[model samples]
Each structure stands twice: as structure tokens, then as C-alpha cells.
Target: MSEAKGHPPVFAIHLTSSATDGTRVLAVGAEGPLSADLTDEVAELCRTADDPGRAGAVQVLPRPLRTPARVVVVGVGAADPAGWRAAGAAAVRAARSDEKLQVVVPPQTSPEAVRALAEGAWLAGYRYRDAPDGPRSAEVDLITDDAGHAPALDRARALAQAVWWARDLTNAPASIKNPPWFADQVVAEAATRPGLTVTVRGPDELAAEGFGGILAVGGGSATPPRLVELSWRPDGATRHVVLVGKGVTFDTGGISIKPRESMKLMRKDMGGAAAVLGATFAAADLGLPVRITTLAPLAENAVSGSAFRPGDVITHYDGTTSESTNSDAEGRLVLADALGYAVARLDPDVVVDVATLTGANAVALGKGMAALYSHDDDLAAALTAAGDAAGERMWRLPLPEDYLEYLHSDIADRHSSPARGAASVVAALYLREFLGDRVDRWAHLDMSAPSWADASDGDLTKGATGWGVRTLVAWLGALGR
Candidate 1:
């Protein structure tokens, strides 16, 4: 866990035909001086994984002079940056078993490629070695150039590592990461970092503060709901940005119970919370001059006697009443309150909220892409540009002025969720009511699809993907635009 301090190290390895002189190079292609150390490390990595097979595409090498240092022969999948990063992440994991080793990646990679390598390595190397732990890989080595701006690279490392921390929390099992625990984690982080102040608003404070939306959604859970606020404004910072996240630790769909299979991955429903925290830490480590306050409405969406029902109408702190269309759509409810609080209290120039808010987003963006909703054209464009730079996919979805009409509920101020078909779009429109005319400057990301990985890509692992932090950090850096 001590390795959590910085980004993982990676080496640039050279592949050679005659590397068979002694070392079992898991050489995937031509070896050269640049990648020598990396090839040796990859061999060691493969050996450590302890698989009896070493398959390289169209390459033959003499077998076993010894344990074979885990021959993870990777194929030249594509000329794309993603492939190289996947290779980098794969190398880190495959070489991981040995106590602290370095895996080499492509040397002539682009800036984005280097970032992808670091992102994937740190992400893949993450292990929540803290909780009642057993045997695990102690640390990982990521090699980078000593030249250029070392300070900036160090900052990059910190940002990537912070993303790692956030991912670790998101990937943690629900048993260890409920509402109170999450609040404590945030409190601890805020306390440890300089230039940060945190506040935890429990059920009583929520009720007193008129956070009816968060209260109603989490009221049924065994654990009470909490509203967590983390503020950072170093000395003379200029811009202030507010980020809100839906922190439903384990959603049972409440009175609107989902099928068992549907509820299995509910722990990851808090992916938005993870993103906010990750972005905050990364911004701090990157030393962004902008002031930031992150709002994570921590709650466990459970099924209990106190849980709000489908027909129930609850009034939020913002004085907006919403009829429960489906208790499962509770994320948006909690987020609505958080967003309102952020706007009213922080009064930042811009606000953004992230959440695993809908299955409909998945239908529209599929598994690897996230859906971006924004009334502000500039905000949407910024986010899209950042996504392009960061290699995270976020396609913009319009929050049409007319779509707001669909949220009409004769019995209440609005419906918790609109009817099916255009669910994700309507959900965005629903949030617009709380944002009001200021919506012209705000953005919301429906990360339901990419919140959790269905498969591993080059640098992205097969679990909590740390999906939005890079794009978010990039977007925040481009704020004035």
C-alpha cells in the first residue's frame, strides 16, 4: 500500500532475435538497445505469472534455459496508441509476481501514448492490499525518461496515482465501503491533504438542510445517507469549480426491487463518487490553480421498511418535488440534491455531476463510451476535446429545452425518471430543472456504461476503470475556455 504514493514505473524494452543467448526474452518483435531492460523484465514477468505457455505471433524462440521468467509474448495488435498502452498494462501485470519489477513500453510513444501507458500501468497495478489482506504483488516498476520536465512528470505521476486511489475505492467490495465508511475515507483524505476542508452532513443535517431528495432515496438502507463536501482553494486561486457525484454504495433498487442479477454489481453504483474524488486529488497533485469543491452524496440504496416507494412523492431541499417513477433510478435523485447544494452554497461559475444514472445510457453509448449531457455548448465541447486527448470516450447528448417537458408529473413537480425509450435523455432534462437557467454553463456525465469495465483494454484493467478522471481533469484544466 505504501507504493500508493506515486505512479508506477515502466521501462522501454528492446526485442532481439538473438536474445536467446541466455535470458528468456518474451520478445514479441525486433529487439534493440532501447528496450533491452524491458525485454528481460517481460520475461521475468511472464515467468512469475507461472503459465506453462508462451505464444508469440509468428515468432519462434528456444525454450526454457530456466523458469523462463514468465514469457508473456504480446502480439503487435495494432499501430494505435491504445494497443501500445494495453501492451504496457499487460506487461506490468504479467511481470508483477516477482517482488518489484519494471516492464518496458514503446519508447517513441506520443505524449498521449505515454499517458496511456502510465494510466494503464498504475491502474492495472492497483491492489487494495489494506483490507484484512493476504498474499499480493507488493509493488510495480514503471520506467520513464529522466529528461524533459521532471517536475511535470512527477505531477503526472501523482495525478495518475490519485486516480489509482479513487479506483481502488470504487473497486472495493460493498462490505467495506458503505456510506459511513465512504464519508470517513473522504474526511481522512481531506485532513491529510493541505489546502482542503471537508464537511460531512449526516441524516439529521440532511433533513435540517432540506436535502429531501438524498434522504428519501437512502432512507430505506440500513446505513443512513451522508452528504460529503470537500473544498480546496489554495492561497490565491482564481476559478472555483464544483463537482457532484451520486454515491449510492450498494443500490437494491429500494421498493422498486431489481432482479438479483440486476443488483449484483450495485456496489459499483458509486462510480461517480469515485470519479469526483479522483478528479479532486488529481487536480490537487497536478497543482491546478483553480479552486474546487467536490460534493459526494454518500448513501446506500437498500430495500427496507423505511425505503421510499414507487408512488411516493418527495420534496427536495431545492424545493423541487419529484414523484418516484422507479426507486432504482435513485442516483439522479441523490445527485439532484447535491447539485442544488453545490450551486446554492458554493455558487461556482460552473458545476458538473457524474453518475451511473441510467441503463439507457448504456444502450446509447455501449460499454466503452460514456454519455455527456450539457446545456452549455462550450462545456460540452471542452469535455469532448478533453475526452479526445485523454483516450476516454464521452459522446455528447443534448439536454434539449423541449426534453424538459417529458419530466412533467401531474402528481408532483417532476417524475424521478421519465418513461422508457428516451430514458437517458429525459434524465438529463430532469436535472436541468434544478440547474435552472444556469444550466447554460453546466455539464452532466452519465457514466453508467463505462463505470465498470466489461473487458480489459491496453492500459485499462478488467475492474473499476477509473473511467472519467482523466477526461475530467483535462476538462477542468480547460475551464476558462
Candidate 2:
């Protein structure tokens, strides 16, 4: 395997009036006039092409008479923000290996639409390669004269870069992404920013501080475990929000080994950690006026003699003893410890934890949507709106009081896994037990299904999709406003 950690290619975006020397991309609506540069011949070609001017449709024409050697016409059906985004992505993808592109923005497009277009273009251009000498992204020029769209374009670039950083971390091979290495990468990235202070606690510190859940889950791995705290404390910030993420670098189900097919994408088990890290980085970059603290409990649940077995009762950081009915259900174990620590020591006004916690989430919400569990109606609404705005949709699931008995343990205070079904709900209920009295201020995101994609779609690649970063960043931005 290649030692290089795959980083997404960067696209240099420019706002210009004239088309560049490379490929020219035109956005055409189903019922609108063609771009001025397009001749009568091209208009006739579009009229005859099947599904021309439909959303996400792409039609490439080799224009011998045009200044640019080739022209790509992308459909912008109804010209909405979503349509514009899809058009942008389809345009860049049609450009293929071209290193430079001039994309024509539709007339009278709003600044929000312009931002969406740029985001979709930049995100679709992302390609993660294991080799250092992999192909780079195209230099894109948004052919428009609207100077008011500058700030929106800049914001789009920042958000895209944050998502790219998250995807890079999540896509890194398990061979080089153990707990220590993960901590090192996060620390190195944080060193570049001034206000973001990072502290990493190793096995000794974790044991001494009573981080039992984290240590127990990581006991089987030779690389050990780490609890990483990243803080951004801005002056005059009234609300303090703490974000905890499960950072299982790779999971083999420990003593309860998983089937071979289920373990192939275990390298992406740390996607939640990547999402929180990306949101924090975006917050710092945007200089949001909100105090944010992020906790990532890192571990690898491998199979070994030292592995914590099923039926073992382990004490979590808050001194709550939990029976491990299934060693494979380890994400919630680490998240519980981190959430408990955050509530006890951080004095947070709000707490949100994201984790790839349960396969049952997929069963309930399919692979495209995430499972959201929160008792606070206000918090649930804010997150749902944020997710909708960011294009990472989430459906709030109930934490029923009736199902609390499913987690009952005869030998311990509570159990990690339930003997009955409703595994996703049970996992969230188990995590809620560690939140102390802050249950109303806490929200949990089970992003197990949406974290990785089976194939490349609109803004998602085949590997890590960096699901929760956008939603968290949007919500934080709203809070800052």
C-alpha cells in the first residue's frame, strides 16, 4: 500500500468575464436562450439531444470553430440552487481530464445559487489518490461579472476545503491510521491555526483519569488509544458547545469478530471523528464567534487475547458500569466516555456527539439519511434545518421511555447492546445514560450508513463522504449569527 495519505485535489476558482483557453462549460435551462458564444448549430444540437436541459444532464460538443476546442453544456432544470449545483458538478465531470475550465454562470442567478454552483463544482472535482503524483483538479473560472458573488464564492471554497480535509482523514488506510497517528495528524493540522489548542491523552493518562470505556475498547490493539481534546475559546462567547466523536480508527469486532464482507470498509470507522475535526477547522477558519470544544476518543478494536470480551462489565468515565453484551458495539462505548467527560469537566451549554455506531441505523433510515436522536425539540429542529441546508439530510428518531428496559443489565448498571431489536434506538438510549442531567442539551447522530458511499454520486465519492461536517458547520454558523 502507498504511504501517502490521499488528499483531495484543489481547484483554483476565478470569477471572470471572458472564457479561458481550456474547455468552456455552459449552463443551459430547458426553456432559456443559449449562451451568447453558442452558435445556431449548437442550439440545434441541444434541441435534438435526448433529455437536453434536464437536471444533472451533460452534453459535450467538440466545437471546431469555437476558440476553446471543446464545449460542455450542462442542464439546470428550473435553475434552482439545487439544480445549479447539479449543473456545476455535471459540467466539471464532463470536462474530464482537462486541467482548466471556464464555466458560464446563468443570468440573474442569486448569490446563494452562485455559491451552491461553486461548491458542487469544487466537491465533484475531488479525487483521492494513494500516489503522491496523482492528477490534480482543474483550474476553474466562473465566467460571470457579478462582483457581489465574491463572498459567497469564498465561503463555498472554505466549506469545500473542510469537507475535503475530513474525507482525506477518513479515507486514510488503517495500516497508518492508528490512534497515535490519528492524534498526530490532528495536532499537526491544528498547529497551523493560532487559537485552536490541542491536547492528546495517551493510555497512561486515560487509565489514571478513569477513561475505562476508551481503554477497554482499545485494549486489543497494539497501537493503544488516545483521547484528543481540541478547544476554541473565543472571548465574549456566551454559549459553550462541546462536540464528541467516536474515533475508532479501524474495527475488527474484537473478540466478536465480524464477517469478512462487513469488515472491508472498517477503515472509515473514524468518519465521525473526521466530521467533528472538520467542523472545528471550518469554525476557526471562518472565525465564528462561538466557543467550541471537540473531543475525539480514538481506538482500534482488534481481535487478540487481551481483547475485552462479551459479558464483561466495564466502568465508564462517569463511573457508570456497562455490560458489554457485544464487543462489536464499541463505537458507543468510546462515545459514552467522551460525552461523560465533556459534561463533567467542560461545563458545556450544549453537547452533540456523532458516531458510526450501529448497522441498525441503515435498516431504519436507508443509506442516504442519518439517524438523529435528541430529546430537545429545539435542538432537533436546528440540526434538521442545518442538515437540510447542507444537503446532508437527517431524520430525528425517538428515544422512547418505553424501550429503556431493553438495556437493563442484571449484573451491571446498564448494558452496551440489547438482547432485543431496535438496535439503533438502544444504542442512542445507552449513550443518553452517560449525559448526566444534560440530556435535554444533548443530541446524538448515528451516521453509520451515510458516512461511506458505495458509488460516486452528486457530491459524494465512492469512499468516505464526510457526511456530518457540513451539517455541524452550518449549525455552528447559525449559532454564531
Cα lDDT, model 2, residue 303: 91
| Candidate 2, residue 225: lDDT | 100
What lDDT tens digits, residue by residue, belong to model 1 across residues 1-481?
A: 1223343322223232223468544443433423566455556554554331222121212224332222345433443445544544565655535434454444454565555555555666566545646533235554554344355446557767766767778888999888999999888876777777888999999999899988998899788999988887866777788898889999888888889999888888998998888888878767677889999998888888888988789888788899987888899889889887776777788888889889888898899888998877877888889887776889888666776677778999988776656898888888877886567778889998888876655556667877788888888777634
Candidate 2: minimum summed lDDT over ten consecutive residues — where?
A: 9-18
TM per candidate comes to 0.82, 0.91
lDDT values for all models = 0.72, 0.84
lDDT of 2: 0.84
The segments of candidate 1 whose C-alpha lies over 4 angstroms from its true place after superposition are: 1-84, 94-96, 103-116, 130-139, 142-149
- The candidate 1 region of ten consecutive residues with least summed lDDT is 52-61
RMSD to true structure for each model, in Å: 6.7, 6.4
Q: Give the distance in Å from residue 314's predicted Cα in candidate 2 to where it truly belongs.
A: 0.7
TM-score: which candidate is best? Answer: 2
How far residue 300's Cα lies from its native spot in candidate 2, in Å, is 0.5
